[model samples]
Target: MEQKSVWLDEIKFKAKPSLKEDINCDILIIGGGIAGISTALELKDEDGVVLIDKGKIGYGVTSHTTGKLTYLQGSIYDDIEKAHNFKTASRYLESQLYAIKMALDNIKKYGIKCDLEKNNSYLFAAYDVDKLDKMKKFLKKTKIKYEECDLPVNIPNINAIKVNDTFVFHPLKYITSLREIIIKSKVQIYENTRATSISFEKDYYKVTTLEGNIKAKKIIICTHYPFFVIPGLMPLRLSLEKSYALLSPYKNEKFNAINVDDEVYSVRFYKDNIIVGGFSHPLYKNINYKKEEDKLIYFYKKYFNKDIEMAWQTHDLTSHDYLPMIGRLNKNHPNLLIATAFNKWGMTNGILAGKILADLALNKQNKYADLFRLDRPISFTKVTNFITNNFMVGKTYIGTKLIKNKDFYKNVHIEMIDGKCSGIYNDENGEKHIVSNTCPHLKCSLIFNKLDKTWDCPCHGSRFDIDGNLLEGPSVFDIKLK
Candidate 1:
């Protein structure tokens, strides 16, 4: 009934628009969430940069995130080290640390009132008590310095392994601050701008929107889930992870002094508000949003004795190696770069990505650029990823061919080639247009989620408007006709 910005509801502003005529820019950044805004803000003073958003800025996945900027991604270091030796894992860790620093510096420089706070982050144990041991061993192998602690939080049936320090801030406030700077820098911020098509000709990237077009020396596919499928091959490598959270009823109402890493759950407090999050599931074809919400409710009822206030659900782009795919979209599309699949760890990652992508766009050098490059090899241990990720994507292909017969209404969810996800709508027009059927994220085939009129993705859990435009990510593109 009531809609407001998640953590920072006080923010108010109007969504901007794309230029209606041909304009040249040094770089074109798509998707105006934290990532796009960060890039545009970083390069705003620099020439030839324009940022566009499918909707309003800060309304994408960045808004729904439990913003905890930290290096501790609870119970991930062990797998990271195991998947690709300690050395490479250390690189990933260091890269994340570098991102954290970038955000800190910008916050200070801009004097952003994003409620920036420093605290110790935690990854506690619920089931496997030895999870911390693997992290310890991995840290030792990498020769990284970290301190452990007994967590002081009051909760039932929990054990804690402390990460030295972590940070939290109001992400929307940070993005809003960047938006102000970008506006002042003369980088156009276009809200409600949907990029319809993109082409590369004569080494100039041309992005066509419903209203106009833009020509740029380079293009960035930061629209959460990329619009075009060719560059990132996002359909194949990334799967959708839908998660839920609740913000309400302060207990000690203590904010996360340090980021807390829990796969099933994450805890943080914003002033008097406590945010409890977790309930990650594959957002595949026929994925149940209600089931996802029920899980969050179960966790809430079990843990806290308070009324739940604001609740939100969102999806993340999870990659094969659990890192992220940044840098060029593909070799053939050299001038195009992509930033997606952040594993729901977007704030710092996105900040670092702005720097790395900005440098690459400028053809300058960035050391970690190699770490997140698009063409990085998928290692042997990650072969399992290929199968699991592909399995999810297969549903899209199958969903596309459900049935064409008009009477095929029993299982009527189908992805039309015209990019429409249609139901049997007897419109006032007295006929059917067979509206946009493609999942907004990665153009996956959407199966009719009987429980919800929402079409569900088998690859990533991007929902859509009945017309097939984006309702969620990793896709920011809505399914609409040309």
Candidate 2:
């Protein structure tokens, strides 16, 4: 099966050219996904604003999302309440609700043809009755109206909480509409422009790309995984989780629901397809992709008699504390901002971050900004979690070095090239291609992702093509070819 997002195929937009020369702008936004575009749209009135993407706009995480936008995230409020406080949870919910409103307002005002649908969102629990009760109590405390109901699906769930005014939409189509407005508003957009390094030159920041440099008064790093390491140190604060998703013939479901049980299962409908997403794990280990797909199919067959049409996978950055870090990259540098660790709910958090980042860049005050502040004091729990998580990554990095070639796949193995480690993939046609096995970001050893046929860094979620071309970041440089 081809690895592609159904949403990407469902919409089309004119492509923007890569940056060909050095340019200066008032603000520079990197990463052309939902967050970057939303920031550009919020700054539409500002002149000399530029946005650049390593690939095409809306083709990154935005296209690959399950596309459910709602404040009823799976026990997230409860989780926040446990970790922080009720006020923090309320602020998070308010930010998300405002994001939903902004999305709806833009869709109606701009008349975006993104198959937007207003529906209720549900969070159900099968065996976790206490969890459901706790969520209900939290909602009651917040004065948010929620109903307890039996789930419509065949699966046996003890209870489900339903919240109204939730939504699902074609993310790419929505992005198309946003891009149209951004273009008209004069935000210079450039695709295929990979940002390599950033530096401070006098009062302005210079962001160097593969083709040219962009000098701007301020910069927003919305690259999903923030690239800069020194100030932000994103890898230490976040862990990457990969999840699989598939599309099937539309099941007439009136609501989008997710179960935050031991195993997660999120379901929503867009157009004639029901998007089933979940089965998450850290992607460092060898995964049986076929087995995961089988699980999704089995679940579908048991409830709905529909054949799966498309399948894909996506990665999300989860903060140790459960709240997204959305503020200055470093406390010392007020002009540099970042937004990461959405924890698979980027549809709302991503856009919400854009608004916060825009406010920071424009010197406007926002009430919810402190909830996701970048320089917040790290709790003991966060510190311990960070240490434990990095230990796993380090283990994987060392273990990959010790694994012998004889134990590798029939068509793939690792070997030394000019005294340097390299991965060798023997294609079905019997042609062997060799590329450096070391990730350029943080020097973590790369693992071959058989499902996607790309080399992935277990430490920070950087991805490179089989030919060593950079596919995604936190890593900006491509792996060296032998």
Candidate 3:
């Protein structure tokens, strides 16, 4: 099946100019998805704020989300409270509400036509009664109003907690509108210009790309995953998971909904279609991407009787502590900021990060700043997750590297080139393309994503085209082609 989001086809965006020479700015923001673009919008009034992306704005993982804008995320409050504290979870709730208001206000102010609709959102459960009870207790403790209701689908014995005044919209449309506003303001925007590396000079940071270098007083690493590895230790603290979504004609599904099952499913409506998204799992060697996609379709077809219109996939980084990490990159690098690990709640978290990051850069005080501090102290709550995630990383590194077999599929094989690992794919037209199988970022062996026909690094979320061109990265360089 072809892998493309239904949201991508809703807007026809004009191309922006790519960076071709070195430039100086007050602040440099990298990554052009929701977080990067929203940060640019917040900083537009400030002088000399520049943003750059490897691809076009709004085309990354943001384009592939379910696009639900709700503060009542599925069991997020319970998870955060368990991982951190009640105060931290409450602050997280505040940030999400603030983000939703910010987005809605901006859409109204800019007259953005993004199909925004006020739909109730729900957290439902069939078998996970304990989890659902915990969510209710958290909601009650926070004083957020919710109601018990029947499941919207045909599923039996399922109950849901619903929050009114929530919303759903076309994310690409909203992002495109925001991009236009930022471009018209003081922000300098560039696309197709990747930030390859960063170095500190006397006082400022120099971000270099193939096109040129950008010298800025402050740098924000908003790329889905920060390319810098030293202080953040992102690989040790995070894990990558891929999720699938299917869009098809709708019937009577009313509210945006998700369940609290181990194998979770979230369904929402857009245009005349119902988008059912779920089937998330950690990235690992020899996992069949096609089978994952099929599983999503099968579940949707079993529940709803509609022909699938489009199917797609998205990848996300989940922080070990469950809450997002947003603040300075480390204790020493105050001028460097990092925002990542939204835990599949990027829509609200990304927007909220923009607000928090802008405050940090502009020297303004944000109430929720300390809640998401990158230098947060290690606690007993975080210890178990840290050990489990890091152990999995080690397993992925050693396990994928040890596979020496050449035969993968009929046309794809792993072999040696110049005494190093290489993947060779012979297309239907009999053209041979060979590229390194080792990720340039951490040397983790790459896995073939058959559904997208890209080489994916299961360890750090780097991706490359079959032709050896970098698609997404912490790895700024492409796989070596021979």
Instruction: Provide the overall lDDT of each model, using Cα atoms, as 2-decimal numbers.
Output: 0.72, 0.83, 0.85
Candidate 2 accuracy as TM-score: 0.95
Q: Write the per-residue lDDT of candidate 3 for residues 109-213, one digit (tens) a residue.
A: 889999999998888886898888888888888889999987777653366888888999889988898898898999999999989899999999999987899
lDDT of 2 by residue, 240-268 (tens): 88888988777576679997576788888
> Each model's TM-score?
0.86, 0.95, 0.97
After TM-score superposition, the amount by which residue 133's alpha carbon in candidate 2 deviates from its true location, in angstroms, is 0.9
TM-score of 1: 0.86
User: Residue 328 lDDT in model 1?
Assistant: 90
Which parts of model 2 are misplaced by more than 4 Å? 285-291, 404-407, 480-482
Q: Name the TM-score of candidate 3.
A: 0.97
Instruction: Write one digit per residue (lDDT tens) for candidate 1, span 203-265.
Output: 798889766788988998787777665633667777777777777767572535322234467
Give the candidate number with the greatest TM-score.
Answer: 3
Weakest 10 consecutive residues, lDDT, candidate 2?
283-292
What residue pairs are clashing in model 2? none
Candidates in descending lDDT order = 3, 2, 1
Q: Which residue pairs clash within candidate 3?
A: none
